[model samples]
Target: MAGIWAISCKPCELACVRQEVHARDAEAQLVRLASSDNVLSLIEADAGVLAGMLCSTSDLADDEAVSLIERVAKLVTCPLIVMCDRLDPGLIARLFYAGATEVVAGGSSSSCEPVSSKEACAKGALRQATSAGAVAHSKEPAKSASGMDAYAEPARQVHDRTAFHYASSMTTALDEPDGLDEPDELGRSDELEEPDEIDGLDEVASRKAMGGRSTSSEPGAPVICAIAGRGGVGTSSVVGLMAATAARMGLRTAVIDLDLMHGNLPALMGIDDPVDLARLLKDSDSVSETAIEATAMMVSPGLTLWGSLERPELAESMGTAVEQLIFALRDPADVIFIDTSVAWGDAVAAAVAMCDRCLVVGAPGPTQPESAARIAQLAARLGVARTKMVSVLNRCTASSLNEEFALRFEMALSLHSRVRIPDGGSEVSGLLSFGRLEDLARGESRLTSAIQTCTSSLLKELGCAVPEGFGKPSEQDSGGLRIRLPWDKAGEPR
Candidate 1:
């Protein structure tokens, strides 16, 4: 039968698909399936009867959409076209990886005031399906202009030679070389014998299944990773302050929020509505320098901010997307800072390994040192050199106990470089309330001096040319720092 199957849970999308299908081919019947399971069932029952499938992502989650497309592609001979509200490069790549023949954007789910060219998009989908029979036997995954397979799973793409070691550990016994086999007394190879289980192999497998990039191809920005030993240790604040300090010194700086789940970089930077990274990923055709520039939110003349995921649950699946984003930002800024969560996941591991400097931030406490030690050990396993790591103790007071904690943290982290930021007292709270955390580097307080010192030291370590007058206090009346206390009037500064 000359018919098209429309798959969507949304009524609006289904109606749009019906209208587009009828407009394209009046004689072709449009069969609407409300769920992926229904479509799968139909395909199983009569795989040869279907002409094509028009799937919409509006009704399914990103992972769900990918899974459905992959399952359907494996079962059906007809073309599988995906209709998304917007064309996100990451989503498109995933869909293509799952064997989608074509992806069309600007459907009924589009947020644009006037819906974009649905007729043309629908016509293109129909045309692609019409030509599917001629090329069905020769279909291959899409490749980028760089000749790299664009649809290749990012996890499967080895970033460097060291990746082979990690890959080897995860490889199954079946993948082992035949050289590992030995002949027994009966003259049969021992290849079929059950091997002894190794300790921590299951944990390694779990992490591998979870997910986790390089800095760039060319010599560009020195990437820095700011990771916390635990939550509330002020890692993000430190990154914001350091990046802002460097930018204020006339250096082009960028901060990427690698904490895909619960990232607060926008709020800390006083940006009420930052660009949604997913939208930027969709709008751009590729992960080039221009695409990264479009994704960045210009905080000031020299500083830029790249936000995290709009949906926190999608963080697990966004490791590759984040890596690609970091790679794209290499040439756009002179220095790059990555703010990562405390959780030790694939994304955090990748960031720690790829950066020029690893800023391990922790609070002054008994447990923080142990946490920092664990992070250091993990970074070592991930191929980060000890010399590249720098430990920072936040909220440090001049008391003897706090000083002792600082020594303990540094000793545990085992890094030559260390920085201590004094507790900002009430002033820090006021700045946070006002969404002016970046101003921590703009005052004469101990916190500001520590931030500037850290920024200068890291830049110097990376061989980045520091401006002639960098880290010096400005001459426009070096007045005492003024901040509005919570008890004071709204317009007053103490």
Candidate 2:
């Protein structure tokens, strides 16, 4: 049970009951709550011992009174007690709702005849509280002052400044209630109950369930994933393959081709047209599901591709649009893949920074690993974590994975999967240009199988559905056009 605590208890009658309880419950401590003068000083001196607080009603009206209280509120994870003189009904309601565990009367008169103005003030406060619908839970009231020599100096220091005035011939009697524990003991009881209530993974799973494939808006979700590599290294192709894999497994995936200068997803994916992504983000309210649908062509169940817009001049205007589109797709997307431009630019960097993960794709070559490593280093400097990144080794065949070939290329990216494009000769480029990448998820092609295996592996890692078709990608396939590898080739540079 939580320890019962009160503040400014110098005149309090309940101290006796508190002391007895403290004596009876060897493990428990009855306590006095903290006041402004000492609470902040103590918190600053030893932050760890601090738990929570109860604000006195007088301090709420005085802005400086809660200065320490507000600061503590932001730091500590414990609950607060709200001790009031006469709480505003509205204020009381809001306080309780905002995590105040209990509210109790703080200053009140305990005697037959109230002598001091402060006593009259406290009793009036009690009446005001009663009028505001608060119950009189504390049976006894606090005692008032005797002569000028009465109070202990430390007790008087609770208020910031004091200007004392003596009443004509008033003398108030005070007897410390048997042995009430002070405020510190009360805070200790609360600290013991808090950790278990807060330290669970319920929030993460709920957010993932609501926000597509990524976990909630918390610290875990990798919002940004970049695909960066040398020119003509199949970067866009890998993005389409990854997006296709996500969609095939029932994810509402979006493939955003960010290569404004020479974006070919629209042409490469065979759309042969332009979709105004920049315009959609500029006029966000007008951009809805229908607008996004028009901007992105559906390739499979829960998957869509936003073809590149025509004027390369409009690339600068596309950044905000991409941001808006990502925000809008939060609940709908299981995976969002961005196909980066050939050269790293502000837009490409911005896209990489925005994603939860990055997939740097490269072909079997000398410079690929070095370029990928530079990209990884920059990402690391910017605070991207190792787990949030993976390298994609595209178009690798058994020949590409061989010891001699691997010796020449030192891999830098996540090489868990490799993409393959058959030598369909001249028409291969034309056919690939118009085809939606989604076909790879269902077709009887080597490329399709390679992509499916990669998707299954990713979904399993992220705790998503594991379809029966899921299989592991291997280091080699003797004659196939494509084979996945878990490690980068030897020569590309580590």
Candidate 1, 1-494: lDDT as tens digits? 46655455477665556544443345667777878899889998988777667788886899999899877766664546667776464675467445565555536656311111223222221111111111111111121111111121122211222111111221331133431122221111222132332112222211211111211233445678887767888888889899888787666677888787888988888888876666444533334334455567867667788877787776665554565555445544567899998775656655664565678889866698998888766654443434456788887763434556778888887565677777777888788767787775687776787677678867865656665656554442233234547565666554
Candidate 1 lDDT at 328 equals 46
Q: Worst lDDT window (10 residues) for model 1?
A: 128-137
Best by lDDT: 1
Cα error of candidate 1 at position 140, Å: 35
Candidate no. 2 TM-score: 0.47
Candidate 1 structure lDDT: 0.58
Clashing pairs in model 1, backbone N/Cα/C closer than 3 A: 87-282, 88-282
Highest-scoring model, TM-score:
1
